[model samples]
Target: MSSGSIFRFSVMAAMLLAWPALADTHTPEEVPQTFAEGFIQGVGVPVISVYHLAAMIGIGILVGIAARGVVPVLAFGAAAMLGVAYQLSPYDLPADDAFVALTTMIIGLLILLRKPISPRVASGIFAVAGLVHGYSLGAVVANAGAVPVLAYVTGLLIVQTAIGVAACAITLGATKWPARRTVLLLAGGLVIVAGGLAAIEAAGLIG
Candidate 1:
């Protein structure tokens, strides 16, 4: 098989392994506030676990690569899937963490709509996003049982993958429109602005 086909199969295998772990780890309960409670309570259900988090990082990389080929619809589909996966997860994050995730998602989407960024750059941003996401995962892991922790991480990976895939489609579509190039530039600018904002927040420069 071709390299592309091999890669696709690998991704599929990863997803298949990740999904069962998610289902196995889930518990029926309302979302928890603290990470400890979340793990024990299995509050996030379908999305919590270390495996899921790794999957998300992988998804982001895949999306970055995919953006070079697919259309915007594909990107949208990916984002939608990520969102759905997040909603399904048993891990609940603190409000601030949720805000960060939302901001990152927006940033990812904007990046997709604009010009095609270098994969390295996209991956760097993804790494930062992953840090925040991982912290949230850690919190749940600390408080919950091993099973819940596993499930939560799994959820994160699935969602991240979806987001990355969506970004790929958007970036690919943007390349075809001359007029859209301006929008793409603006989107990039927004990413810079968002990054600045995130930095400020991290430094405790803003509330």
Candidate 2:
């Protein structure tokens, strides 16, 4: 790899390692933060939030394998909107980061197995994953008010959809190249590693 690429990966690894080694307790609180800052943070979280990012990447890879990015993305978005509504309502669901970790691991394993599941089943799986992920995201912006929270969610949706679509495209491209299966399996392996670490972190056993 190029030096610049190595450096960037190193930075990302460092950031991921620095994610809280315990259950997430961050709640959105009103402050001097601006709308632009909120939007930026929303976009950045999928990249910087270690456990979440790990799960997202794993799920994205699985989506790529399934070659159905749109279903999961839309399902996730709808569930996320519902999650936000739950957050804004009287109902409460304690979102432990462990769920995210576990979900990611599941998705990674599925990719590794390379089993053929129906599209509807796959969508259902992704939707459940979305619920877990969305609830956590909703919690993060719980106190940011309706409009700002909506804006943040919008940013999240855009970034997340992009990531999913990109992963799918890359996987499709790899499948057309020589040693396609090998490349796909290798990608799956990487997702597993990332998910495994995130799982450990979520368990508070390591960071």
Candidate 3:
């Protein structure tokens, strides 16, 4: 089957699993207000949150699948940092988990395609994903005070940078594998599944 076919099937499967009437529900985890005194729960919680971690991992893999460089990852990191700055500013965006989930879907689809896209185009996509993710991180610490907020933003960037680089390396290395394409297709499908679960949870239909 082609990449497009795989993506379409993944979407359909996700939609079926996310069916409002048939899905099982679970409570979203309570984000702690603080993490060890002065350590910055505002930043720490989001960093360790399963949802955020999953998103980061998915994004990293997508970047790797598309190309074999760190530019895209850096692009995402730069935009995300800007997003963190925006969060600290006098502006706020609605805390919507669905938005994040949708972005995850986009990244998964990109990975599913497994196409070699232009560096500029890939960088742009990663940048957009980064911005949204950064904003999400910022929301968690919006009320954690200046010090914790700073630490949180810094931590997010650091963690993402590490994850992104590692993901790129792994994908690049997979190129030598005889079954690289098949493995990537499976990874893309899994990412889609993760995104679907996230969307369902965000919609409050399940956890």
Candidate 4:
């Protein structure tokens, strides 16, 4: 079947999943019970989450400053799938929170400096961040049915790719400006602060 067909079927499945819930008078918003709902939730959830938003901004900067191809972006998406798969499994990844904080901070540092790392290293950073973030994202749909999960993944990739590409484009364009370095430094500093706060919160040093 074509990808479009598969997506249509997925949506149909989600609607079927919703029928019983609807008949029972359950609140759809209480959980993702439709493909459209799941996809929207997936797209908006990451952007709305403060820590993830900051980290994503840092990621976009890293991508933009590198001025490389989409390999890093693709790597992130692929690795994110692995993370979500793991979350769907019976196991829990150890030290995930610490590792996420570290990655977030490192990406911020790189962006703050406005220095492009090697493509290989940059892709690795993207993968690590994607894995951790995806694992966390999976929690939202952990108990969801197959169709909603599929829709969520689809929307997650679409939105994230858009964000990464948009940021990279802007950064690339900004490179010609005289104060490009200063602008990059300011953005990176913000990411660093966001990452640091995430780390402190994870460590329970503060609420």
Candidate 5:
């Protein structure tokens, strides 16, 4: 065979072999599983699932664009808080953890309305939110045991960091008033609506 053909054949064989290994490394688990299992089963918990992850990443990019005047450190602090909130809180379809979800929405809206808060302030807010996020993971760990818990939390952290980085990049690139204002307005509206829904749920108005 020609060199090109041989190279193609080798590449195909490698991919074929790699496929099974990847599958073995990431098999799905049975139901009644912990939050982490659910997260890992979907391949990460950054925002509960792929759809949520995409939504949050989009939100982060918008927030970054709106907050362009801020430095990377500050922008990242805000983004990280949002990321943790999106990931750990049970805001998925079934909507578990209404309290955390409500709190996150309130905080997100506050950030959207107010000018870029100090990095110190953002950091403190994120620290408190992070504990709630961590506790959500701990709940999973307590119920599901170690391995699944680790996998779930690891996936969440990896996705959270990536989204935070993307948000910072968006903020760095924003330079126009119209785009920034639009993002802030839209994000603010979303937070308010989501917060309202969460509040209702927390008050026992929703299932």
Candidate 6:
């Protein structure tokens, strides 16, 4: 598709994704009690939340652009897992909408900048971003049992890895065509919008 077409499609997709998310809503209660429960929750939770979904998708795309290979994906996953650990530990940092909103915005900026970063640099960026995103995700299972938490982490890694890989592939493929690269830039702009709105909502600015 042409860049314009891709941009238009991305705009529509963003609107569809964002419209429902505009409302102030809470995620339904689904504590991970059993391994099954944890696995289900882990697989489902990231996409269900708006900022989380954006962050994960943005991460995938950025990784695809900034670095080549699966190592960056693994770095993101591992760092995210570590973030979860920190959240569940005494070193717990903030895990609020505001925090995630910031992380998402950072991803947006990185994508929008369009600067060439080395693989090492990209890996570092992905690690830090993943940690922030993971910390936020850890809130859902902060108190789960060991077995369930294990299952939950496994599920999360699997789902995120899948997403990262898919997004990376699509991004790499699309960018190969000079006319299609703008689509990713426009998509990055959407990520910024999403993050900005999330921050606004978090601050009770749009009520």
TM-score of 6: 0.82
lDDT of candidate 1 at residue 189, scale 0 to 100? 44
Order of candidate numbers by lDDT, starting with the best: 6, 4, 3, 2, 5, 1
Q: Residue-wise lDDT of candidate 4 within 77-183, one digit each (tens)? A: 77777787788899998876666677777877887677777779988889988999778777778888888888888888877777666666666666656556766
lDDT of 2 by residue, 1-207 (tens): 344434433443343344435324243343215677567656766665544565565555566666754576566656656665666677777544676667776776787787655568877887777777777776667667656676777778877777666555555445444444654465456555666666676677864
Runs in model 4 deviating more than 4 A are: 1-30, 205-207
Candidate 2, residue 18: Cα displacement in angstroms equals 14
lDDT of 5: 0.45
**lDDT (C-alpha, whole model) for all candidates:** 0.43, 0.61, 0.62, 0.69, 0.45, 0.72
Candidate 3 lDDT tens digits, 88-203 = 67986564466667777777777789877677887888787777777766665565666655665666677777766766656655555556677667666655666677787777
Instruction: List the candidates ranked by TM-score, beginning with the highest.
Output: 6, 4, 2, 3, 5, 1
Q: Could you tell me the TM-score of candidate 3?
A: 0.73
Residue pairs with colliding backbones in model 5 are 64-171
For candidate 5, write residues 1-207 as lDDT tens digits. Answer: 344433433332233234322322111335325655545642443344222332244334334544543333333334434443444446532333454465456555664664655555655554554444444334433445445554655565556556655554544444333344555455455444544544565567854
- Judged by TM-score, which candidate is best? 6
Off by over 4 Å in 3: 1-47
In model 4, state the lDDT of residue 64: 75
Task: List the candidates' TM-scores in order.
Answer: 0.43, 0.75, 0.73, 0.81, 0.56, 0.82
Model 2 clash pairs are none
lDDT at 36, model 6: 95
Model 5 misses residue 199 by how many Å?
Answer: 2.0
Best by lDDT: 6
